[model samples]
Target: MEAAWVNILMLILILALIWVWKKFNSLWLTPKRLEKILREQGLRGSPYRFKVGDTKETLKMQMQAMSKPMNLFSNDIGPRVSPYDHYIVNKHGKNSFIWNGQKPRVTLTDPELIKDVFNKIYDFGKPNMGPNIRSLIPGLAMHEGEKWSMHRKIINPAFNLEK
Candidate 1:
């Protein structure tokens, strides 16, 4: 009986250590490693801030921008709608990146580069969004491979020039 209890405790301790390591790796180590890789590749942006990243700063900027009324004569709504993005673009140039929580979002200003990414669908994969956000906005954009093709086929007719 004593030996059995000791074995069970040892198993629990091992499991607990594994869980802790996984949490630490996912929450801190992975993000830091990704940040380092991006920085080394000549991309510039705000440093990763634990789990929250730049979400707090983004929300604050958005709220402040939206508080003011829009200019009737001005067509520049980018600043008002996406204040954080606007600030980032202005501060860090066109090829900069921003942290959306643990994910790093690289902003590409060149039309050709954007086209190339869209063309090579299999080469790049979409980032994993939380369940809450997924539930709120479920659509073709979230899908991949066969599902994406099916969804695109259904929606393509709506975007036809002849229509």
Candidate 2:
């Protein structure tokens, strides 16, 4: 009986891991089919990075840019030393791909998803942050159930920039 129970537990754990990995892969892993999608539509950009993504490089560049004086940036970094902002400068041409980790995201220069977002913003849903990502945030954002709602309410005023 004990051996059977252990075996069952191990199987369940393995299955759960497989599920999470598959989910992460489907959303965040890839040689990114989006690349082809963009290419077929006629676009250009940088090659995608595998796994750890561009997050690390972006962060590094951003931090490096920030370390210098704001006024010194345009001169030092050649107009774009910051990470996110450099995304525009980083694009050697009109179209490009920026890796969000292993995932390749299509950068559409002419795309108006931005306007569409603000136009019918109410209809759109919150961006998916992947499973339990907030939990890793190391703050009240990790709370769930009623606790999360309460946390949000309590911290709302604190986060208000105007306040």
Candidate 3:
């Protein structure tokens, strides 16, 4: 009976250790490995920091850009609207990456790549948005996969020239 209890406790400890190892690998090791892979592929960008990543820097850039007033007639709003994106592209080539939290978002400025991405929508799915944000603005923008396709199909006819 005592031996059986000891065996059960040992099994539980082993399982706990395995769970912790997986958690660590997913949270830290995977991101570091991915960062190395991305760099090796000639993709340049900010180094990944634990947890928040480049979100702080992105927010700071946005705040600075917003504080500065641009010419009202200027058509170039890309710099103002996406200050971090503009900075990253200028600082680290157009094929650079940016982190929205833990996720790395590759900036594809080339028209060909942009078109390809649009054509192959499923290959690059939408980011996982939290329930609160999804609820705030519920529509086609918040949906994914077949639901998004269905919504687009339903809405496309509304904008057609014949209509």
TM-score of each: 0.77, 0.45, 0.70
lDDT of 2 by residue, 65-138 (tens): 66766764345554444566356446645455666765665454443554343334347444456667755664
RMSD of each: 5.1, 10.3, 5.2
Candidate 3's TM-score: 0.70
Higher-ranked by lDDT: 1 or 3: 1
- Winner on TM-score between 1 and 2 is 1
lDDT of 1 by residue, 13-41 (tens): 99999999999998899999999998898
lDDT of each: 0.85, 0.60, 0.83
Best by lDDT: 1
Best by TM-score: 1
Model 3 residue pairs with clashes = none
Candidate 3, position 101, lDDT: 67
lDDT of model 3, residue 66: 91
What lDDT would candidate 2 get against the real structure? 0.60
Candidate 3 lDDT, tens digit per residue, 1-163? 9999999999999999999999888778888888999899889999988877899998998999999999899999989999999989999998889877676889877765665565566787766779999889888757877887787778766544477
Model 1 misplacement above 4 A: 127-163
Whichever of 1 and 2 has more lDDT, that candidate is 1
User: What's the ranking of the predictions by TM-score, best on top?
Assistant: 1, 3, 2
> Where does candidate 2 stray beyond 4 Å?
1-31, 72-81, 87-90, 105-113, 116-125, 129-163
